[model samples]
Target: MKNKPTIAIVAHDAGGLGGMEIHLNEMIMRLKEDYHVTVVASSLQVTDSEGVTFIKIPVIKRPVPIRLILFAIFASIRLLFVKRDILHTTGAIVFNRADFSTVHFCHSGYLKATGGSRVSSGGSFFRKLNSGLASFIARTMERIVYRPGRTKRLLAVSNRVREEVLADFPYMPEQVGYLPNGVDIHKFKSIDDETKKKLRKQYGIPEEGHFLLFMGGDWPRKGLDLVIEAFNQAAERFPDLYLLVVGKGEREMYQKMVSPSFRERVLFTGKQSEPHHWFGMSDIFVFPSSYETFSLVVHEAAAAGMIVISTKVGGVEDLIANQVNGFILNRDRGEIAAALIDILSDVERYRVFGERARARVEQLTWENMHRILIRHYEENDQRLGQKALS
Candidate 1:
């Protein structure tokens, strides 16, 4: 029998920790069954990788410029020495080192949309210095990683990301492939009304309150401020409204964004391992993120039979059929409150929308995502074998 094709997956982090890290872990776990899997990451804290070989490379934690440059150098050097049929990397300026590279966040697109320069006109000296230094490293890395003939193959997290990568690298329009992030439909299953009632009671949630959900790690980027503002505006119209925010963002910081009248109703569960429970209890899933390559949470919520009210950013339009499954703000902040009011005021409409939302995501399970990924890995394996014979 032919030996299984060797595959190496490189990510900055490992395990089912954080958002992207969890997906990376899942990919490794899924692929290990078909191939000899190895993972090179800066930090790995999970033990679920039984069949996978792991290589740890040291890099200083976040916001440190020297750390990434050192990581890129070390990761490139290591790949050159390792023998593998396919090399998958999360991000870095490793160029041809990684055969398949996943673009989770398009740094160049972000810079282009926000601004080329990171220095603020009236910012403090330290803030300006940090921003300027980080910007320089990021933009430089983007150019190197996305340069023509540098990347062997590019996979985007969303269609919007595919467009952004192609926009940055003009020749890659046809080459870029995108598959939206997948949710485990089984894991995020909807509970019956009785079960939801039990969960609400366990979490000290009022049965009378309409639960609005927000799940994300970054508060600023996820538009949590706007969530608070919109929730406040709708609070008067939709009585007994409660917002349950799950993830890393500080509850204290976000509470300031909420109005005094409804501040106590906002609850933060912090970061959670199984956020699916929260999704099952939510009346609506609201994400007004400023940008996203794709949001796994949005689909998770949908799978739990929850209606989504999100800003039309990134690949949200790919999932939500406005007024059918959910409402899309389409980048208009003003529409957030209006959308919330419409869904809250009409119970039948809300129920129908939630059902459609659930139906829309029923087909996009993690198993399907793994199948697509396996095809990509096998194609690379075949190409590598052919090259060896030649």
Candidate 2:
């Protein structure tokens, strides 16, 4: 252990159960064999994880800007004495003093999508004021972290993300490494009829209906509204169709969007803890998100042997084989509805697609992801050492 490389993973919520945090913890677990790992988080819940040192930085968590700035300062200060050969951060906002960072999503790309860009900032006075200020700070921080001669490596989770980062800051293309996200193939297992029936009963999804699933955090950004619109349009033709959305967003907003006759057919599970069970119970997964670095749930759906219908966003192409495994489309309501109709229209096609989806995802595992990450860990550390000596 003493002879092994010391790696420090710094994130705002390393111990949290969100997808990024969970993957971070899993990465820590996997690297423990050849490295001494430590996690620096804002708040941490101690678990039976052997060989991990959790450093919690006390910080308030209301109003995200304050939390980000405070955590960045605290974590930066704390890193001064964190004896480690390499430091990995989940986000660029915090602890810019790092060897490498996992570029999950580019802030500049998100700002462009959300209309928070410097040139085209729009909204009410207060909204614009807040947005402008936040954007300025974030962009400034990003520029500093990604400046030329900085020598910090960037690990992009997907090609789309790498492109996004390079689009924002054109010079860092060579410094960026392409790394994709992975799912636990074993956890996203297909279930039998009995298991599906039990899950449907537990979630109040009618056991007899053909289920359409959508899972994401934000309704607008994740294109939950788009899914609802498509479902509403298609529900009229297929009475057995049921749309089950498991996400964190305005349920009432979407509920009211659905007509009185179709409201009952739409069910919002309100952020499920066990997504595998939801995926197992689902027939088809549909998500038309506006922008994504790499949608992890899409991989989970394919791994669970469900036919996926997503938009042409981010690294979807890496996971989907177009007409073979899943249907990747633009954000057209008619096109989305038509794709759903085609899948439901043909039983044989649906089965083949699901089978192909499962088979395609079989190669995507956490072990593979871990191996790639660890390789980069050593590469980045060695590169930094060479630069220091030069």
Candidate 3:
């Protein structure tokens, strides 16, 4: 093997749409500096970088049992052709026992964290069936692919995910590593205040309104219903308050769910090209998701000096301190209302929290996350080397 091992980053999802895609893109851009990185992704429209090579493959979009199994079969065959020392699969994919495999947990733990019953069915028969089947297969695959007998490592994005992995698969605790997802803090910080205002005005938002932004695809999981409810109750108190939702998924369904009185107060800017501007325009970031492995939106919100309000899920607790940077509440409507009211009532406190939130996230840049990921690669490389010698 060469001194700098070849690293293959593979995912079964399209690029730049979801949290997994974001993390994969950030990791690929950063890892290109030191390692020979090649990305094998499902159909996506991403352009290739200088040193990174992206190969497109056909795979099923839905996370169904049969589809995932087929994805694994195709990925295993593809891996056989690629020359790499370590094969890291994000999301969920099983690799041959002969290769060094690392699976990063994003949503697998949320099934347990929120308890199975609270998970949203999203009113789709295929989705419901896929969720149940995926849960079962995930449990079974963890045992078969990451067993102590198999030489592979598991990377969890948060300590919570690490706990979930240990609790679900106790034998693999020693094989797991905790690496949180990071944001491009510089991209957010470099934007001037004038640009932020222009972006807000361009989106039809008033200059002085207290904009509350929610950015995510899974509305039910991210607690958009609760956000709308809380905003409805609090809207009468603060007339200047407005809600901007930036993402696409079941928009018509969610729009029907919103009360007529509150409909005008809320705006849905579907799938933004530049999401950072929405973060900049908003005075506070509100995410009330009941289940999350780790929310990149909260990090992005905090990086843009927006007071973050999220539930205690995944690694959210690590990034936020109640009444310090932002607020953390239960799924209760009353609690969410109270927290929103508190932030809306005290502008000075909100400003203070926003500054603190920005300061807290300054250290969580992509560079820092890449450094930690490289450490994991180096550790794995050394262990593989010693095993080869022994």
lDDT score, candidate 1, position 306: 87
TM-score (all chains, Cα) for each model? 0.91, 0.90, 0.89
Model 3: per-residue Cα lDDT at residue 233: 85
Looking at candidate 3, what is the lDDT of residue 187? 67
lDDT of 1 by residue, 1-390 (tens): 147667888877877655577678677777776677888888776547677788888878756677667777887788787788888878644545567778887877877765664323344687567667766786687778765467677888888888888888744565676656678778787788888888888788886668999998767668887888888999877768899998885667678888898877889888877688899887888998777777888878888988888877776778898888888875555688888888788866678887888888887766777887876655656664444334
lDDT of 3 by residue, 190-296 (tens): 25567767877787777667888889887887888888888888898998888898998778877876678768878888899888888888777889887777778
Candidate 1 TM-score versus the reference: 0.91
Model 2 ranges off by over 4 Å: 45-47, 113-135, 170-172, 381-390
Question: What are the Cα lDDT values of the candidates?
Answer: 0.76, 0.78, 0.74
For residue 304, model 3's alpha carbon misses the true position, in angstroms, by 0.7
Name the candidate that leads on lDDT.
2
Question: Model 2 over residues 88-166: C-alpha lDDT tens digits?
Answer: 8886766446778888878777777657544332236875576566666676677777644443788888888787787
